[model samples]
Target: MLSIIVAVAENNVIGKDNGLIWKLPRDMKHFKETTTGHYIIMGRKTFESNGRPLPNRTNVIITRDKNYKAEGCVIVHSLEDAIKEAKNDSEAFIIGGGVIYDLSMPLVDRIYLTKIRHTFEGDTLFPELNMDNWNITEKRDFEPDEKNEYPFTILTLDKKK
Candidate 1:
């Protein structure tokens, strides 16, 4: 299964200056839980923002630079090549940065979204999802705590038949 995992605000913002806008630790933990041990495909910028390869998972970085390399991660020239590398995995995750998210949106079979309740001013935004093409398979709301600034909902969407 190909899946897209991201946290989006009410305005569809996902990042600012190549970094995440929110500082929700719970959301981060959820992300780690979902993508751990899966093939994670992301663009170069996203990989850089993460600082290092995620542990216990296959990190596939998609970059146009033929000579680009990141230690402990697989570098691929295109999204297709990244997907091909992940073909044998039971589930591969498309982790973000806007461009990769947009390109993978149509190709993913599932979406694991953390829907933040507030809007944020951000340069990067997630592609608008068409509800007609997806069905919510699961949903759980989280109330804001001392550690988290905003209330959020985790929604799992499956491609509609």
Candidate 2:
């Protein structure tokens, strides 16, 4: 299965200045737990923002430029390459910046979304999802915590086959 994982603010903002706008620990844990041991594919911008490979997962970065290279990451010039690399695995996670997310959405089998309750001003946004094409298979709401500024929910959607 191809799973696309993304965290969005209430207004659908995914990032600011090519980096995440919020630092929610629980959300971080959720991402780590769900994507561990699977391939994590992202765009070059997102990979650069992270500064290093996420542990225990195959890191794949999509870039249009052929010369880009980073330690411990498999760089590809296209989505086709990313998909080809991920085919050996049972599932792979597309963890992204806007460009990669937009390109991969149609090819993914499932979507793992962290929906934050509050909106923030941001420069980047998640792609618009077509609810008619997806079925929500799982959803769990998280209550506000002392450290978390906003409540959030984990939403898993499977594409209608």
Candidate 3:
């Protein structure tokens, strides 16, 4: 299964200055817990933002740069190629930087969205999802704590059959 995982603010903003705008530790934990041991397909910029390939999972970077090379990462020229690289996995995740999200939105079977209950100033935004095409299969709400900066909700949405 191909899944898109993201954290967006109330205003749909996901990042600014090529990095995440907020620090939500719980959300980070959730992302790690869910995506661990799976193939993580992401855009080149997203990989750069993260600085390196995450351990324990296969890292597939999608980039237009034919000569692009990231040690320990499988580099592909397109999102389709990235998907193809991760085809054997039971579940592969598309970890985005806006463009990759947009490209994979229609092709993914599921979405794991973290809805942060605050607005942010950002250049990158999550695409508006049409509720009609999805069904909420699971949801968990969390309140802000000393470790986490904002209140948020984690939702697992499956494409409608």
- How does each model score on lDDT? 0.95, 0.92, 0.95
Q: Write the per-residue lDDT of candidate 3 for residues 78-104, one digit (tens) a residue.
A: 988889989899999999989999999
What's the TM-score of each model vs. the native?
0.98, 0.97, 0.99
- Candidate 2, run of 10 with poorest lDDT: 142-151
For candidate 3, the TM-score is 0.99
> What digit string (tens of lDDT, one per residue) describes model 1 on residues 1-161?
89999999999999999898789999989999998989999999999999999999999999999999899999999999999999999999999889999999989999999999999999999999999999999999999999998999999999997
Instruction: Arrange candidates by lDDT, descending.
Output: 1, 3, 2
Q: Candidate 1: lDDT over CA atoms?
A: 0.95
Cα lDDT, model 3, residue 103: 93
CA shift at 123, candidate 3, in angstroms?
0.3
Instruction: Write down the worst ten-residue block by lDDT for model 1.
Output: 14-23
Which residue pairs in candidate 2 collide?
none
